[model samples]
Target: MSALHFSRVVIVGVGLIGGSLALSLKRAGVVGTVVGVGRSAASLEKAKSLGVIDEIASLEDAARGASLIVLCAPVAQNFALLHALEPHLEPGTIVTDAGSTKSDVIMAAKTALGDKVAQFVPAHPIAGRELSGVEAALNDLYLGKKVVLCPLQENARTDVAAVRAMWESTGADCHVMSAVQHDAVFAAVSHLPHLLAFALVAQLVNAEDAALKLDFAGGGFRDFTRIAGSSPEMWRDICIANKEALLREIDTYEKVLAHLKTQIKEGDAEGLERVFTRASGARQKWGTARAAVTNVEP
Candidate 1:
């Protein structure tokens, strides 16, 4: 397939996702210029030095001239940035985002951009490292990953196509879904998992033998709690933004946990084994299928 090209692309946040997108586009020679806008001049300068951006500009200034604008900031921050970019966004400019949740972002775009919401595509790339910031960005970070695009009712076909093409150029497989569905799915798979990991670590910290227990923790703890080391601010925003769906998932998980607790307390080894065996088999099957479908190297 021929690569999609853009004359100019403005990235509102020069952090991990935004920087990686800029690097990927530049490496593919699919974008002419990438202008970065951020609240931190130091971070912007670092992004420029890393060659993830061609220059730095105010969000309004950058949005005015770009063929595409990508918002990679936290969910809450995107609201203000979207409002600021509304007046400056041209008719042909396609605006998209790399937020974790879609429903909230779609709502923000509607409230902030009004009629210009037609050009806005809410996207979430299902890929990331535990580390963040521009320094951790990689050109191939999104290669073979999944990107979900939740298009608004006002979005034109051409605009949606352009957004898909942009992510495709970054080597992502794009899928389309309704905003409500996207949020619900991600809340169960991504948001709730992160919350669980964070909660596990918090529980450990509150334990009387916290320090000694952590000191003796093995690979199991490390593997399970890895995401607990993720950006607190970003996860905080996502959890709150998708609180409704996340709460539902949490409730479901709690019921399952209570069932397991009851089995253990009653010394029902058969029941415990049945539950563990079922979960273990399902996890193994999912791992194999996900690897096959995504072609992601382990």
Candidate 2:
């Protein structure tokens, strides 16, 4: 079985992730033709000009002869997009997504693709930059990153393997799991952190001395809130799509914070120190483990 090559790949959203995927695929010589389909003509044009796509076409037109299709749009819109794309997709065209949420996407695919659900693979590439758009696309964006695939029950072994191979060609380590498990893991680690970052920045922005505090903000503040500057619409969709898991994570975090607050209020230095030490140690261990896994010198 061929691993890397696709006769044609149709990328539904030619924004950062989609554009980068297109570029990386082309660079690897895995795709013969890259067709980008998006609502914004300007964005598609930019993607084309930057060589992220060989051409731009309507979803109906691009799906005509594509061997593979990738939905790189927000999770909320992907449901409708899949329905809209169903009639246009040619036989044997394998579909996948670069969405953050998995369960909702799997349900959407099951509903829209129906009998053809086996052709669709739900995937999430756990890598991104703070930037957005075709202009911010990088060919190496997924290199050394993780790409999680939650294959539908209908998916055949070959379909999953093809999609996994595509991600691996971009230097991403591919992992397969159930949609429910993927969502729960990501909700705790990625989604919760993004929400917290956004909340912290919002709190600061709405503060009485907002301008003064922002002006005096240091590296730690900037680092923690960097994700707050991400696409609002995208994050909003992610939060809503994975609301259940995210809420559970938020509740757990709140409980932890409340316990720490009580420690501080009671002047329990020992408790505070214990909590801080545990958290610090855990963070350091995680960082080191992550670096080792990704083979990055630390």
TM-scores of all predicted structures: 0.97, 0.97
* Location of the lowest summed lDDT over 10 successive residues in candidate 1: 289-298
Q: Each candidate: what lDDT?
A: 0.91, 0.90
For model 1, name the residue pairs that clash: none
The count of backbone overlaps in candidate 2 is 0
lDDT, candidate 2, 54-79, per-residue tens:
98898899898889999998789987
Single out the weakest 10-residue window by summed lDDT for candidate 2. Answer: 1-10
Per residue, candidate 1 scores C-alpha lDDT tens digits across 207-238 of 99999999999999999999999999999999
For model 1 the local lDDT of residue 169 reads: 83
Count of residue pairs whose backbone atoms collide, per candidate = 0, 0
RMSD of 2: 1.5
